[model samples]
Target chain A: MRRYVFFILMIALGIVIGIFYAQEINPVEIVDAPPNTLRADYQADYILMVAEIYALDRDPAQAARQIALLGSDPPADIVNRAIVFALEQGYAPNDLILLRDLSEIMRTWNPNLQLEPGGGN
Target chain B: MSLPLRPWYLLTGLLIGVVLGVLYAWVITPNEVLETSPAMLRSDFKSDYRALIALAYQSSADLGRAEARLALLEDEDPARALAVQAQLTLGEEGGTRIAQALGQLAAAIQAHREAPDDPIIASLQAGVQSPSQATSTATVPPPVVRTATADPAGQPTATTTPSGDAENGGNPTPTITPTGLPTATATPGAPFVLLDIVLECNPNIDPPRIQVYVTDAAGSPVPGVAAVVSWDGNSNRFVTGLKPAFGLGYADFDMDPALSYSLRLEGGGEPVDNITGRVCEDAPEPYWGSWRFNFVQP
Candidate 1:
């Protein structure tokens, strides 16, 4: 029984060392992350820009394509999330209006036409 | 059943444990990568980011904010990035406005970076609300306009007209005061009147611009004045001094040689109509070039 106990102790030590090495020494670093990897705030700002351009050009197809680049969130949902985030963050009234307008448009856009966001996030 | 204690058993257990640990650490759970930067974006997505910044700058007209946002891209030179992208994609469908915005922002940033000491640029960096803020985001109403008092017709010219010293050739002087606060010499409460029109013949100007320079009676370039360009029932409004590199008192509109445009400044003046780029015979090859229009408040 003492011999078995010693073996288990050694195994536990080895496992601890291996975990430490894998996690701290040579962990994977995602330097080339996709747009979907952006934080919630940046995602909101990027979505706002799309709304501004959409307000000008009124190109739903291109607008949908641009928003879809961020991730697979349905265009309307993505915009709606941004609107909520914008409101929470106290975005200017004009900017909030633009975001809401975009959300409305995205709601009607055909999701079947949405393009897949490229690459792993 | 009791077995003899064996070193092999200990080694086998240790090896198995290590393998499992490594697998679990690497695959089962890892540090979540949060707050990924714009700099880390994929190459194509980086282009999209640039477009977003450019478009935002077009509406916001905030030079300082544009620079700060662009810095996140980790570009060695943000202006060069904008210029190169504008050039590469200018010909694509639906790319005209994006290319123009990128090009304009690129020109503004490049000018700002190059002339850090200019007072006008200094004031611009300090940033008060710009004239663009007065106009609506989606559609800009064209400002009122009138003809030059000196030239009744106000037809754009390849050479300087007889308004004032056109000695600077077709080019508007880039910066007036090397050091000092931004000049307030521009006549307050007055509208910019068409003063001169000169066509520039430069090999570099491919999509020639309708370059505008607004100055006061003192010939000091003015910033923050509004101008409008209309062609084929479509109108666009932009404020001068936005691109300080061109000149603190300068602003320009991209002109398609195929289309003629009408220009109007904010105060009452005869609108400068029939504005279009003409061929520059003096160039090494015949090239359609930019038209330069000078406006001054009375």
Candidate 2:
């Protein structure tokens, strides 16, 4: 009878320890994006696309090409403006495409887009 | 089962366990945390006070540099003059970073100020500034200035559109008296204005509110009338509640993570808007806690 009672006490202690271990939580384990990560601008699409391309490989011309494909409606300085915007955003080619649709929408908007006319060694 | 059970053993065991657990918690726990409370509070206060003081120093330094740069331009340096103007604008905008640092430091200090006078806390406060209440505060008076009287009442009044030394009204040859005060003087041939905004917060107190100080083209404080502070996140505009303004301007808002922010000041019959230039968001959470900044007029 005494042995059975001791066994029950050991089991109860184990359960309490297990519960405490399971319940422990880290307060700082939140996965939220840093502030000002995204901007709401017409050229942001080009910037995002350029970042994706740059991250994969360093190709300013290819990035420029991707930017030129943004939308059918052309802002006067569209390609050059996009290039500058992309550079400012520090878009690398490998960056994950967080806003793919936004890029696609921009491409559909600028149909006559072409690589900025002036670039080479 | 029917026998009388006093259960004395169970009660005694529970009491002993509780007492032992408390003793272990008090003695075995890290002493660093226990000893750090007072020093930590004092350090926090000093940090906050340092923000305001550092800002005061930076502004004074920038003002001096600007005046010197402008004075050099008068000796025929047009290119240098343009560079000076750009530098001044950068310096003016940079005031925000200083202000924010000061706000955090001040909040920490206020916490120490309100804590009970434990010897450790008292010693910490004393190590920073004397702990005695009598030494905490020492009052001083504003400087006296003598001016020629036009009106029989002899009340000094500032005239609008002051220029060409005529504003002094025959009180020519102004004397420079430095009594450890911040002053902004506009030199001839290179006029400039600096607006400083001071924000104060006491987390120990109720809801944290930021105070905005509004000054004129001169460093002199602008009083009366209210200014409205509006931001991009909130729909309603936050109007300043206090008056005569202290340094530049003040507005309070709950801290948020968004880096780019816009501030608009509309009051005293004029409206000015500004955008923050490249906020440093990727910093230690502590550094990014709270920010105080100033908006200078264009």
Candidate 3:
């Protein structure tokens, strides 16, 4: 009986040691990104890409689906914010013109939605 | 009941098994185990992300920020990476919005390198220098300036007529005659010759479109000319129209991709024959399939 108990404990100890040693060999690292830290520039790019997609498909609902990826804000609100951001950032006039045209189309598509005045000062 | 049990043997066996298992898990298996992270994107998504960064760079004109974002893609050459990805996507799925955006982004990058002083580039650079000044000063005048410079000898005539017509907001019939006559007279006795032909195939658009431009030997755009495109075994006849945006020389035609095309100048010039359209990329659907024909009367 004594021999059996000693053998069982030794085996258990070996298994535990093996697992502990393995972890030391390869440690898992965890990184935490801050919450609500979406970069505004990235968001702006996302909005522009969505706008381009809208231009291709001409489907407001489909565009709205893409805009939803940014946040809960409506597509029009996101577009308005993007336009303001692009203007403030001094995006090329041609690109700004396209964005303005997109905003107009979006407004016409969704009458209830309010958009910021385009071509900012 | 068989042989006497030996505890030492059992203990040794367990120890051996544990040691072997640990060695396999930590040493041999480590290499075999594929490490994946939620943060890591697949190759396709990574390419799409790079293209979006490129487009954003176009708008923002922030190279430092663009490079930083591109670095995260872990690609040594982000532009080439994008091209390869775009090619693959086009081959697999014909012309898609993603594929189109990728191609345009690549073209834009190339264009920026070629023409750093271009209005878009200048504005972008200015935006980097002083945002407020960029917005105020870098409005859309460069193209207008280019148009003005193209007619340096006719500056007096070019400036007076166009500006007058522009202000009146009336049909510029008077201005057209003056500009057209000078272009013809400027180049004395230059034969109208076929300059070059290009085909652009875009699967994204149905019924491919062709753009034709006519220019003088001096490369001045010649307006109010007709370009004809036809293919063998097809009764359809195609003609080019003046596309002001592309210049006075520009004309366009929507063509059937299945048939080959031949281009000839309506009034004179040799015919450009045996023009065939193919899938621009290996994508399952044909996108951006196009051809360009240039006619020059030198």
Candidate 4:
């Protein structure tokens, strides 16, 4: 009778232990948003690009004038769109800088490339 | 001779095994906990504080480098490093940012500094020798200082109208002689209020790291805190001797903006407490605390 009682207690302890193990909780993971979701960082990049283009302008006044003439004299928006297209093709910041420099050189040396601002908005 | 293995021998072996097992499990086990001590907790806190300070130092250095880079671009490398160092020591974010931009301006000054034989920046530096150049200028409205009084409660209080500079108020008779360029003339007509600040620490600075954040009524950052900072990390005393800068309601000392830090709201008259995060990159929010502080207002 004692042996039988001992066997029953052993089984009961095993069941309790199993229940506790089964109820164990796992840790949760916290994931941050992807880079594309960071709109502010992206905006900062775009603004930096715009500033770079202006930086290539000869003087502050001349740069301002050149930007203003984009629609009527030479379309800066079109240039920006072309740059954007290049970006879609995986152009980086440094590449954009080179492209901007090339555009400035063209505006200064290659008169033929300059477009009327009214041609494109 | 063996007469086979005896039952007694088997029982003896089993008894020895049981005794040994009990001893290993209870008396001699390496995993057994003897006692707990508070020293371990103190050590951990100290270690955390050190880690935070190290992180802040690294961040501050990076910011200084970035600022110095701007000056390198401008060609003013020597003064660039000084400005960067001052910004770090000043422990003000706005001042640090300004120092960064001025680093670029230093590059412009470099053209002068590089030519050891010629002194170009020497003249420009002399030309720009005004506190106004280092600080911002806000048109002080009149009668504000006269109306200003300390708040009975400890919160920041303001005067309605400014009292002009004590030396010259309202209209002053000018005695000016210009040498080609614009002369330095006192604007006695304009009324202005000066914000002279004094900072005090109540208790000892036990926790080495503390972050201070000052905000305006609208919760926007108040700039120009560095120009008026005074704190001794070692003495942990009430620090005085603050100089006002040429800017709106902003000043700071004993804090570097380059590092990430958090301010914990503590009870009345207690110095502000701060926990530092990593520097250079955006600090992970809900900072890791290593130190505490107690700021007494003067």
Candidate 5:
């Protein structure tokens, strides 16, 4: 029984060392991160871009879909967060207007919007 | 004849340790990557990012800003990559709008490359340089500020050998053909006239094609000419030199059977009408034929 216990202790020690080495000494690099991991400033820029497109196409649905990609936050709040970030980062005035316009759209936008191709025709 | 079983348990423990180490390293508590740029996005997310950039370009028409945004992708030949993505999107359901936006952006970039001094592009550039807009442009990190031009100082010249399409004669050459010459050889007012039109029955190019080639009066291959093909009240726009394997002056549009189409250079001369695909019975498997139209500045 003592011999068996000694072997088990050795195995347990190995596991702890293995975890420490992996966690501290040689960690794996996570290169391919999703868009949700984008830095706050880049995410804000991305939101600004979506706003710019919404202004041009006036397709609130597409705009909503794009903003929704930045995690599960409400689309309106996502744009608002971006607006706050853009303000803090000293983004240009025209760019801010674009972001604000997108915010207004998202605030009143439908989450279940779907396109019916050539529907009115 | 006893096998050496004394330290076997130690060896087993070490083996288990290594496996656990690998799992711990790769799966559990993996290294967190922070402050990742757009270039670090996974492949599918990168595609979405690119499509959004194209949509924004379609809206703003700010060619410089669009070019800078594309540069973040770090593509060797942004034009060819955009063209390839446009092709990929063409096959996706409901990808027409995205594909059109990509093609339009590529065409606009090419146009700006060929004729940087065009009054329209110049005015847009002026808008892009507004102090407010300029501040946001400067906000991009250093590496992301790359130009889409074929050759930037101290950067490798872009070589366009985008995957050869089975329809485009499966022979793709490693053509370092200038994707961006930055040389303004365009006589903005010079209209491209019809040089020749040849209709062919090659079964290899199926689903029919309208190959349009535009050249200068000196007969040099002129790339980046916008060709608009309209059929039955529907029109599509594509740019030349997108596929370097075909020729620098080459651009083509897919054709549906029996539809009369008109081809014209956007902002240029008269439209060539009565352009239609034909049925070629030359091969045992009869396929629709294609038309090749050549235009040159007279």
Candidate 6:
């Protein structure tokens, strides 16, 4: 009886230790993601909204202010970068034009400042 | 060598194993599993991830956030990567949407560059000592600021009226002038209320075309009105009194079937019409596309 009880306790102890070791080895726990997070499509839509507003107002300064909400780069640099990015992204001609027009308008509005050269059409 | 085992010992061992196994499987294991790495994500969700980053940039406008989000996809150049993906997938139904999103992203970036605190804006403001000073210093006459006239509701109101010469003649001259330019004796003047816009797709022509019509409050077609059509980053100005097939109020422009287009009457508020290209399905005579827009004075 003593031997049997001793063996049973030993087995239980081994399992408990094994569980602890397994946890230590792989500590990652699956977690649920938070809700209300923005998706990529939503982000793209926001960008379109900004472009529409810029086109409507033709106010580079105001447009820049709104764009600054997205990133730290100067508006002109951002525009130039965006142009290159858009072209690289294979954006439609009309969509590219909207960005280009904004860039041109910005350049026209501030000729003295040197803006980054745009890449391939 | 097998040890002599008792039934009680065997039963006890079995029970212990079962309980512990269940506990380990249920309580010890994590609830969520990360099935994919960033590398795997790039292969699977490259375009979607890029679009999300672009969209996120709009709300946050933070390059760092954009970078971090892009990093999850292991992309080195977020914009360029998206552009490449867009190009690769061009003509696919989803391609248009991706391209549009990319363009919006670029526009947002450009807008950010023009912010008030930007040196460029500051310099421009500083350089302009006065309106007179600016005008005097400029080599050419300052471009007129043609703000689109907005109605009480803030919507741009485009009105078409016959030019002084055209109005004098009860019957206007031929639609196309001797020089081959489509001429409309329309001047930008009285505010004709814009009633509606109609879009028609005609695939009979080689590159498709968009025809526009302008009318007055009495529903009579207004002749010699000017309209501007813009698409694929280019703009063309045309006038009514052309395309006699659609009558004096009608004007038309050839368009690429693969492209979408927007139209604004010369005195722009917002674009009066935006037409998306649809596949032409004329048996044995498929052409790119076409559209028609109707505008009226309220």
* Candidate 3 residue spans exceeding 4 A from truth: A1-121, B1-39, B47-66, B91-96, B107-298
Please state the error at residue B19 of candidate 3 in Å.
Answer: 9.1
Model 2: how far residue B272 lies from native, Å: 7.8
Query: For model 3, how does the per-residue alpha-carbon lDDT over B1-298 read when each residue is reduced to its tens digit?
Result: 4236675567785796568557756767545543422124555445545655544444333333344455455576554565555545544544344443444344333322333334444335323422111121112211111111121222222211111111223434323211221122114445467655555544555566666655555444454354667777553322221223343345566777677777776656677776665567647754656676666765
lDDT of 3 by residue, A29-119 (tens): 3222211123455556456655554454455655565566556766677788878887777655555665676676666665245333331
Which residue runs does candidate 2 get wrong by more than 4 Å? Answer: A1-121, B1-211, B232-251, B267-289, B295-298
> Mind giving the per-residue lDDT tens digits that candidate 6 earns over B269-294?
35754576655665566555555565
Model 1: per-residue Cα lDDT at residue B155: 19
Q: Select the stronger candidate by lDDT from 1 and 2.
A: 1
- All candidates: TM-score: 0.53, 0.20, 0.34, 0.19, 0.55, 0.28
Q: Clash number for model 3?
A: 25
> Which CAPRI category fits model 3?
incorrect
As for candidate 5, its clashing pairs are none
The number of clashing residue pairs in each candidate reads 5, 36, 25, 24, 0, 26
Task: Provide the lowest-lDDT 10-residue window in model 6 chain A.
Answer: A33-42
Worst 10 residues of 3 chain B by lDDT: B136-145
Give lDDT tens digits, candidate 1, residues B158-195. Answer: 21111111122335544232112222334656667777
What 10-residue stretch in candidate 2 chain B is worst by lDDT?
Answer: B136-145
Clash tally for model 4: 24
Native-to-model Cα distance after best TM-score fit, residue B179 in candidate 5, in Å: 17
Which segments of candidate 1 are over 4 A away from where they belong? A1-11, A110-121, B1-22, B30-35, B91-94, B114-298
Each prediction's DockQ?
0.24, 0.01, 0.15, 0.01, 0.30, 0.04
Candidate 4 lDDT over B1-298, as tens digits, reads: 5336444454454454544544444454423432211112233322222222222222221222222222212223433443344344335533443332232222222222222232343344334322221111222111101111121111111311000011122234422111111111112332122222222222232222232322222222222222222233321211111111211222222444334333322222222223232222223433222221222221
Q: After superposing candidate 6, which stretches have Cα over 4 Å from the reference? A: A26-121, B1-28, B32-47, B58-60, B73-81, B88-91, B100-298
For model 5 the interface RMSD, in Å, equals: 10.1
Error of 4 at B194 (Å): 5.7
Chain A TM-scores in order: 0.71, 0.26, 0.55, 0.24, 0.69, 0.48
